[model samples]
Target: MTATKADRTPYLPQEPDLAAPLRLFCFHHAGGSASVFSGWQRALGDAVSVVPVQLPGRERRFDEPRIRHLPELVNALDAQLDPWLRQPFVTYGHSLGGLVSYALTRQRAAAGRSIPERLMVGAFPAPHRRHALVDADRLDDEEFARRLVDLGGISPTLRAYPDWLRAAASLARDDLALGLNHGIEAFEPLPCPVDVFTGDRDPLMRENDIDEWAQHTRASFSIQRVPGGHFFPWDSPALFLELLGSAIAHTGTRRASVA
Candidate 1:
């Protein structure tokens, strides 16, 4: 059974059997929700079961306050995920979610808990790399809204509508706050392999930033260049599916034995 919000743990989505060889856990970027991975489940093929983790204060969990601390979120998730650790799994996170995935793995390692068999980070820099960043979260409401629109990820249609715009701005502020406050102390590569993917035109990540993920993973590391901008997965669903299928297949062959 999945854990509930009252349990003070991360809540896993309800799904089918757990015997699948490839169980992929997906985490969303800032200001996004589990809905982002809605179509991915079917596109990933029957062999691979896609489990998307829903962060608090978004989508159906709108009542829940947004989580600002990465470790706090990871700790809560770890508590719930430990039970499911009985089976092999892989983690796939995008942008902010990528950092969350890595942090979660580290937390598991520290507690001697079972960890994912592999990690897949997309459109995000390596954890150990220093970044010249800003504190958008500290800005006033008006300024925070301006920054969100400037970022260009939020849908223009939503920005046009006042209610949607207000909601989006709130989420953007919380997401930025989470990123700004979160810090990576050190790097300890997971026992599993790592894969990094990025859009050739993604302005957020430089070529070196993408390549440097290799240094953080003692397991095998691979990088791929997909088409489109930062949100390439949304831009090219078919291509993303192809790459995801390949990753799942590779995981089945290697499992957690890669070194």
Candidate 2:
């Protein structure tokens, strides 16, 4: 299937066997682009193909308006992602993206399509476990910006530019709205397993919150704490790659069915 601007701009590095046993789709945090996963192709190598999901209003699609609600974004992705599901896909989502990943998995199951082979949640707490603390949508611009800085998810260069600052704020606001408004309607665990990754120094995610993710999945639940803060993937890619490899290695057997 042909790719589109509305759909995430996927980058494939050194084509792996197109029919490889496993494909990994990565969703970046808010104000982040698919480029975040560019290093992953090399890190993952031949065992798996890495495809990064690019949400609208960012990177190549800068002119598009940001989507502000969870359901709308999820629905948009559900349609765009349908043709891309080449079987036995696994999803890895960080921060705001984690919620989207979880919802997408549920939607896929509800639609009677092949469910992801595994779900990898990173940076964020389980949807149900997030504390009713700071709501980015409700925060003033200054407060919101501070929250982003505190989370250390946005880059310093982007934070310095006015245009990028506004764009980042808008994207952050919309994403926060989407994440906060996500619905939890009787979510059943996937038939496949799930792995959660969190940073030991991440101020936003507590260890217990990560542990709570176990309830959302009936499959074997595991959590690993990396060295860096919330943006561990950027700070320590080597360690991140190793952790990711371990997660993928644990799912060695060929999946029987995508569904």
Candidates in order, TM-scores: namely 0.88, 0.87
lDDT of 2 by residue, 52-108 (tens): 888877777777777877778778888777666645578899888888888887777
The C-alpha RMSD of each candidate to the native structure, in angstroms, is 3.2, 3.4
lDDT of 1 by residue, 134-251 (tens): 3564577666666556545677677568788878877866765556646675666677788998988876788788888887778789998898777888877799779977987787
Which candidate should be chosen as best, given lDDT against the real structure?
1
Task: State the weakest 10-residue window (summed lDDT) of model 2.
Answer: 8-17
Report lDDT (Cα) of residue 243, candidate 1.
95
**Model 1 Cα RMSD, Å?**
3.2
| CA RMSD (A), model 2 | 3.4
